[model samples]
Target chain A: MAEARRRILVVEDEYIIAVDLADALAESGIEVVGPVGNVARALAVIEAEPLDGAILDINLAGDAVYPVADALRARFIPFVFATGYDRSAIASGYETVPRCEKPVDGKRVADLLFRSIADR
Target chain B: MADDSPAAAPSPGSDELLRVVIESATDFAIFSMDPSGLVTGWNTGAERLLGYSETEMLGRSADAIFTPEDRVAGKAEEERRVATAEGRAIDERWQMRKNGDRFWASGLMMPLSAPGLGYVKILRDRTEQHHTEMRIRESEARFRLLATNIPQLVFRAQADGRRSWGSPQWIDFTGLSFEDSMGFGWLDAIHPEDRDATLAAWNDAAEIGEYYVEHRVRRATTGEYRWHQTRARPIQTGTDDRDVDWVGTMTDVHDLRELQGRQQILMAELQHRTRNLLAVTQAIAARTLRASASLDAFSTEFAGRLRALSRVQGLLARTDQGAIGLRELVWGEMEMHGDIEGRVTITGPTVTLTPTTAQTIGLALHELATNALKHGALAHDEGRLGIGWDVAATRPGYALVLDWCESGVALPHGRPRHAGYGSELIERALPYQLGAMTRLDFTADGVRCRITIPLRSANHG
Candidate 1:
């Protein structure tokens, strides 16, 4: 038996950042679930698909990604936050989640995602 | 012995003292009147103070020195009777001088009863003091009027930091009356968290004679805390260099404070956005560098991608509506190739797109147009291109379907040997970034691509 390609969701609103994130994840030999632009689409993807892990932008357009974080936590799924904001910008309870700042290194994020998923 | 009895030795003889007092007393007019209230004698002070001469005033009736109104009212007769019965009479009234001018006179008349002279009278001019007192009354009235009418809370305190007075406005605002706010009781009106600091500032001002501080105060109307700027200046009573009183004004600055707070947050947000934009630009440079084949290719492609991003950013900034129209995005990318009069056709209903969607689709359109000019359709003079879109109602949720078809030009020898960044962007980026289903193909006619995305997620403006 062979291991399945890990489907990881990417939630961000910035266009180039989203594309680059998807490309980075794909290059890491893991399947990408979404590069969802907002919270609603990210929630829809989470509901309709079985994701191994997820990477989230702290802000989607002008809305905070806390609702999506709450949902992911409720389901016991592992996730990391990718943001252009400081750690203080994240809401409480989600502070312990790993964060990768924007213009993140691809391999570093890949390792973070795998480690978070493995812990889960 | 003489030195030890200085008090008595310094006092001159009675006769000489009388002559000196009568001759040298310039501030007091000393005169004598006969029993019938007739002027018998006048001194130099009387001449100077009343503009009268002893020759002209002597033997004249003392009633002559009274104003006509007082004379008609029998005030002089009443003064003579009072002086005779009680031995002394003191009065303040307007009196006439020899020049017929009136002056404020504080006068005292006493019975001498030493045979020749029956009574002695002394008069002092008090006009300057009277005017000064009147002016002080008027000024105090004006200050009270202003303090009561204006919106600020006015207060007066002693040099020891004890409040002595508070205007009606203060009572109305803080629900503390003048007596209630006396001493340090006014501190109760300040917010608890700010009370100690406010007291400290006030104490500091006591030493410097200047009080200035901004802090939160409780409003009596709703019991809510609001910011106020309280300032005061010390009133120095004389040249003694000691503060006598403190006059202060507390202005309601809650709205201004809130505006300043919002401005700080806006400044911080602006900084965050600037950094994020730089990060985005850096990411584009890295991705463009990775995709280019050579230095020239990197420069051209990187500049083109940056231009695309900048154009979309311009549209977003101009609208400020946070969303861009789909028709505008399409035309912005295609108009660069020249007119679409006969060579290209764009047909789509006006639809607005979120900034994120506009940016992603904008880059995708740039790739498609670049490909059309390089290899497939626009590369030939006779090629034709048609781009159209429609809202599909097939599924429970609607979908936006867009089609790109190039005709009138021969296709390539089959599929190309390798797929470049252009194909990967159209086929892979659309699905991965936008959750859209995309198809790209090369037929014998030209290149064609179709895209479908859930309207709920993709078409929301």
Candidate 2:
């Protein structure tokens, strides 16, 4: 069977950071998903798309992205956190997941997402 | 019975004139007493002076005028003896008046030639003069009392610079005896550093008769230095430009001077810290803008990060060398995320961090947490996270290891179409600033990131 191309979702509040991350992942040969900036759009995209892994920013226009995290968890999908705050600032339940500090490195995101999907 | 044969009788006019002279005298009680001291005659002067009328006192004994104590001491007899042998006598003594009150009296008595006339006496009241003398004595006593009890060192010296007197208070304050404080011995208590200058000032003041001022003395009890303002003036002067004495006092003013010095040092330190903070803020702004693609995105993200930096700066301002509790740094960053309690997890031993390390770690942690909430595990309610760190001793130096992990979040469809600022900051900028190695793992179930920083880098930064 041919290896399936890994898919990722990027939900970030900063447009330039989100764009940079998407490009880095694509250059690494993995497919890119929506770089949604708001919680509502991010949720809609998550519900509609098929993804293997994801990268998330903890804040979206003064709102938390925990609801999106909750929906992704219910669907049994995995994601990585990318935030500008310390990991201690993240919710308790998501403590064991990996986190990438921003401004995000595109290559690191691609590498993390691919490894996460391959391991699963 | 009229005598017609032998001698010429005195004129009636001469006797009348003698009665008128005695009646007009008001200051003295002029009367005649017999050999045994019985009163034989009283004039209007005697009536007014003794508060007794001539009719009331004519038959009374003159000895009754002496006070009880004077009479007991034979003062009346003493006056009689002096008058009889010395021809006349004058004395000052206490005497009782008709009202039973006492008056100080100046009395004179003379022997008379008439057989029945033993002595003639005159008395003057001296109570007003006695009171005036008493007031002058009391004023001198009060001045002495004040000179003895004052806390400051006090001295009185002759115009020629010889110490005439020093208050007992001076001996107590200067740890010297009255004799020691009289002259040059008083200068021995002055601090060695200030002794020369103090002596010069004192000599100048004495020579020129000018007011002396100096802040150069040592405390007797503690042997500590203090500032003292000594002032003196010529109190009296006589003929030929001779000054009688000079009086002076010394007071302490050391603590006020020390407080002013400390205040100036603190002001300078504050100025230096403010300038350092401004430089750091400028660097952060320039970096954020350079990496941003557009003005809107740069402003939003830069402002947010700058606010985080400012919070760290506020904490640093309160510390002596820009150090703070590690826990405080963590909490401050979490609070910036707006209700991050339910969305964040932190685990570590409590520790203090230096200013530069705190800032570097703070910015790195901020970027990571922001990303996690926006796109990773914290994006959904059911998603979970874990964060922890540990310190270990290594060959080069101590090492700090931190991990962030997430689970229970679904992946997105297809792939992310655009690169963003968050990714570049976390993977590139963080390692560059911290001089550390970092790893990021994205999985089907969650994401994990680990960073290892050398102890030296952690401390210096």
Candidate that would win on DockQ: 1
**Ten-residue region with minimum lDDT total, candidate 2 chain A:** A12-21
User: lDDT tens string, model 1, B1-461?
Assistant: 76788676667889888888788987899998898888888999899988889998888887888999998999998997899889899998889898899888999999896644678999999987666666766766887899899999999887555898899988999999889899988988999888877878777897787888898888899999889999988865333466367888999999998998798666655655655566577777878788778999999887877788788888888886677887888888988766666899899876677666677777888888887888867888889999998887756677778898998877766767777666776787667666779998877788888988666645543
Candidate 1 chain A worst ten-residue window by lDDT: A82-91
TM-score between candidate 2 and the true structure = 0.46
Candidate number of the best lDDT: 1
Question: Taking candidate 2, what TM-score does its chain B reach relative to the real chain B?
Answer: 0.54
Highest TM-score: give the candidate number. 1
CAPRI quality level assigned to candidate 1 from its DockQ score: acceptable
Once model 1 is optimally superposed onto the true structure by TM-score, how far is the C-alpha of residue B437 displaced, in angstroms?
5.5
Candidate 2: stretches off by over 4 Å: A1-120, B1-169, B195-216, B219-223, B226-310, B313-323, B339-343, B354-387, B394-461
Give the range where candidate 2 chain B is weakest over 10 consecutive residues by summed lDDT.
Answer: B271-280
